[model samples]
Target chain A: MKVLEQFEFLDDVRRMDARQVIYQFLNFCMIVASALMIWKGLMVITESESPIVVVLSGSMEPAFYRGDLLLLTNHHDEPIRAGEIVVFKIKGRDIPIVHRVIKLHEKEDGTTKFLTKGDNNRVDDRGLYAPGQLWLKREDVVGRARGFLPYVGIVTILMNDYPQLKYAVLGCLGIYVLIHRETN
Target chain B: MAVLTFMCFLSTYYNDDLADVNIKVGSVQVKNVADFTTTRERKDLAIINNLGVKVDLSQVFNWNVKEIFLYLTAEYSSDVNALNQVVLWDKIVMREDAQRIDIPSVDPEYYFFDDSKGLIGNENVTLTLSWNVIPNAGRLPRVQGLGSTTVKLPSTYAHSSGRI
Candidate 1:
């Protein structure tokens, strides 16, 4: 019965006036564009390429659990210090690792080389880095964690873990928007 | 939830005081060891002896703070590197654990490895205590303690066969 109802909704879309269909399409586009604009604005304000990240591993346990949301800011003027949590990307690795800066060496020319370690792990992140990479330079750092929100990123994790649920949610939202009646 | 987090941040944002913390370095033993982790060259290894730390961090904890990551670092300047900061010891203070940290003598948790021979006879090596407050939902503020101590490494290095 639910499948038949959804098929009837598809028929309703076909029967709609061409002008009305265009208006609905334009509304959807407007929503997506505004979301993109907001994201870009945040990137500009924070000075970070990716301003937000979700904790995906338990290496930083007791402080940052899985599915926690983290706000990051990367300022070129700010020097990375010890004990500061940073999100860095290794060469050839797609996923960025979030760890705490434990050791740092700064040269006279203002270049800094540092080492990172997870809180729960016994050793530093040398094994996690690319082969022959002894130290992480300033360019490797993505951003420094500024703020945190717990358990708010569970929705994103769930969608990534279950593709069927993602499709179902997207399909339902699309259908609802298409059939939505404007009172104005 | 957003409002609550904002309110929590506002309440503790101005409270920057980390309370009184005392750190002392008794005797530092410096040795040269082969560096397999990084460059194949020999590295200066400094082992701290009779390290004493006492701090009452009970007042540092607020409702928003979940835990505190305490670390002791050795900061020095050398010809090899203008500035070198190596963490010698660290501890995690949970909300349920006693916040009053008092230790007369303790073993160093991590090795103090320098890329070059910076730790040998370094006269201006300063050991400072710093902490990062892990909040339930707010900014992660890193505040350094008020007190620190200096240690001078011996001019000669210890034997490599000595127990680390």
Candidate 2:
């Protein structure tokens, strides 16, 4: 009976490492905070709300696949040109579209309107724009694509497509960190 | 580790096989049309004449290259924004066999009108042939070809073609 009690007490102590638990929790929080800070810093440097974007569709087939990743930069003073790929978000839409600029209309007031089309697509993006919106304004542009990597962003796509998988992975990570005690 | 090696291999592979690009601005026709398709208030706009663009992009093809998106642009200076650029024509080359493009007399692929009505009286506009190299993997880059021509638009407005 005494041996069993001692075993139970040892298990309890091992399960509830108070100092270790607090340290692990704080480490997790620090990681999350640093990630956020880095993302926000990138936004400021790139002058784009989302400096990095994952190619979500094959509309820009042959140029960008569904899983590729694109790096973007938005220079407010820079003049936009034709044939350049730009990522723009339409009004009332959460998803952004990446396409090449097919046309540019520079107004006398220095504001320019852009017309975009996918290289694989036959028709222009007139139908993709908002109702009564003939052209995309400068304000509507998210950023211009500067660089890209192939298929690294598939992880993001997988996470979004399978919420169960995402939850499972996240839960496993959390549990592992919480239970893991530093063997110093 | 495999991905890193592949990326390094791709970056080292520099295939500069683009032979040549030739573009000829056939004519510049100015017209005024009242169309509901465009939101422009001005009825006067520049109608680009069919371009005689001959390109041998066969050399630009490689194992990593997917497609070449070529566009003909009319770049000119204006008081509005210091530079007024518009895409007059564009073509997508999926394969090298489709490289020899001979469009005898065709309108601009998209609208060729300028926002500040700068297309009219825009003489000495430069026409350039540039292409965006789409790759199966690695970085996508825009390359400007050596083919370029100058077009001078007549000051008078030509008769309308009744089409955009």
Candidate 3:
């Protein structure tokens, strides 16, 4: 009975004025829109579609661990060098891989191809590439890691792993925002 | 936490430097091997022996540093591609481990293969020592050591049967 009492605030919504209800709903939308605008701004500034990424695997252990936050930047004009950590996506693969560049072959015309291998792994990532694809081109590079933060992305990873937890948190936040009245 | 991490980043951002390194390549031997991983065609695989590396990386260690990923890359220009860089050897130096590297002579850890026969008689091949300083929370600065050495590769291929 006590657990269900939190939802009793639904009655308060019916009692609130129409203008006040609309004002709170608009405030919620503004918060979401601002978050989206910030993300899009980061994409433009970093030149990477996804400027931030979470390390989901331990392939680059001792450097990046699971749930670590990585800041990525993709400068199309800059050349990728050896020993740099790069995040790349393979064709048909949904998840991107973060690895170190061990080999680089650049042509005179500014076209370059490179091979990657995880620092923790024994072999190169040739097997992970698309079938018959020996090298990764500049187009395949999602971004190059520039900054790192430890254990900041655990919340995102946990939400992805557990669907119910994500829904519960989102629902609670929505209800709290809708019922919260600003006292002038 | 964010302020502390930012302070840690600023403290080591410019202070970290990798210098006083000496690298020597004694000999290079190229062999023709089947490229099973990629093209599936026979490619030139070059092996460097008696590699001498001496460096003091203890100064790179700090509270903000987690680990150092050190590697020796061979950079050269080939006919097929203008710029070619290949990593021949690498090592991970944890904060607790010894930071000084004093190898007298050792073979490379990884196979140095060329897409074509570019490794043969490459006189301008340069070997440089570089490392990535992994931080607890900050920029991943890559620093190249001060010293590097270039060695010429043998024009003829070594017999694949004989182990060098």
Each candidate's DockQ: 0.83, 0.50, 0.85
Compose the digit string of candidate 1's lDDT tens values, residues B1-164.
78987898788888884778898777778998876668867889888889999988999998989999999988999988899998888999999999999999867877888878898989999999999999888889998998889888998999887344
A61 Cα displacement, candidate 2 (Å): 1.3
| TM-score of every model versus the real structure | 0.92, 0.82, 0.93
DockQ of prediction 2:
0.50
lDDT of each residue in B1-164, candidate 2, tens digit only: 65874675376367554556677665577776654457646555676666687777767776666778888888877656566677777777886547666666645676666655565677768888788877765556777777678777778878766555
* Candidate number of the best DockQ: 3
| Candidate 3, B1-164: lDDT as tens digits | 78998999998878756667899777678887876656657777887778998889888888988998999998999888899999989999999988898988855777788878788878888999999989999999899998999888888888886342
By TM-score, how accurate is candidate 3? 0.93
Candidate 3 overall lDDT versus native: 0.89
Please list the residue runs of candidate 1 whose C-alpha ends up more than 4 Å from where it truly belongs after superposition. A1-18, B162-164
Give the Cα error of residue B92 in candidate 2, in Å.
2.7
